[model samples]
Target: MIYEMTIQFRVSDISKGQHWYETLLNKKPDFIPHDGFAEWELLPGCWLQIAEGIPSIGSGPLRLGIDNLEIERDRLINDLKIEPFDIYSREEVPVKWATFSDPWGNKVGLFEYHNQSEKEDRKKTIVGKQQ
Candidate 1:
């Protein structure tokens, strides 16, 4: 059984990648193991690693669950100067989501559950695990 997981994103330059990710995540990396790598504990057991290399082309829109989709989209657009993107949902879908690319072309996405209680509960679970 898998106890934990990490997703790695490669970029052409570590310095630019680090700064962009720090701004997007609103914090510095939780760990920096070397000159060309950084990692963030995005959730209880989920880690995101950014490394210096050629970025994966057409790989993903790695969607992250969030509390407010619109707010984040707006903030990222303003702060990162990213092209504006729309948040979308369907009647059968439980969450709304938006996808965008980082400076190095890593696809990143954000989503928000339709149920506020469920969202709060998930946040509590993650926070409790951290504490």
Candidate 2:
């Protein structure tokens, strides 16, 4: 059976990429095994990998769940100098989301759930596991 998973995003410079991701995630990488490589365990079993190389033309908008999309977006803009992006939502959808790109053109996004109880429950579960 399938188990944990990892997703990778390439960058032209490893040190720059590592610093950029650290600023974006607001935390240091969970692991840096060797030169030109770093990893962050975003969730319990989900890992994000950064490697030094030419980035893919159209790689990904690796979306992350947040407690406050607007707050995070504003911080990304003011602190990271990211251009302001639109936040989108659908009547049928339960979350609001926005997409932006990293310095190396790696697409990234953030999302916030509308249902407070659901969001809190998920946070509790993840935080509990981390504890």
lDDT by residue for model 2 (1-131), tens:
76688999999999989988999998999999999999999987889999999998557889999989989998999988989999999999999999988888889989999999888888887666325
Pairs with steric clashes in candidate 1? none
Which regions of candidate 1 are displaced past 4 Å?
Answer: 129-131
C-alpha RMSD values across all candidates: 1.8, 1.6
| Per-residue lDDT over 1-131 for candidate 1, one digit per residue giving the tens place of the 0 to 100 score | 99898999999999999999999999999999889999999977899999999988765778899878988988999999999998899999989988889887789999999999878788787677324
What TM-score, computed on C-alpha atoms, does each candidate reach?
0.92, 0.92
The TM-score of candidate 2 is 0.92
Worst 10 residues of 2 by lDDT: 122-131
Question: Counting only residues 3 or more apart in sequence or on different chains, how many pairs clash (N, Cα, C under 3 Å) in candidate 1?
Answer: 0
Model 2 stretches astray by more than 4 angstroms = 125-131
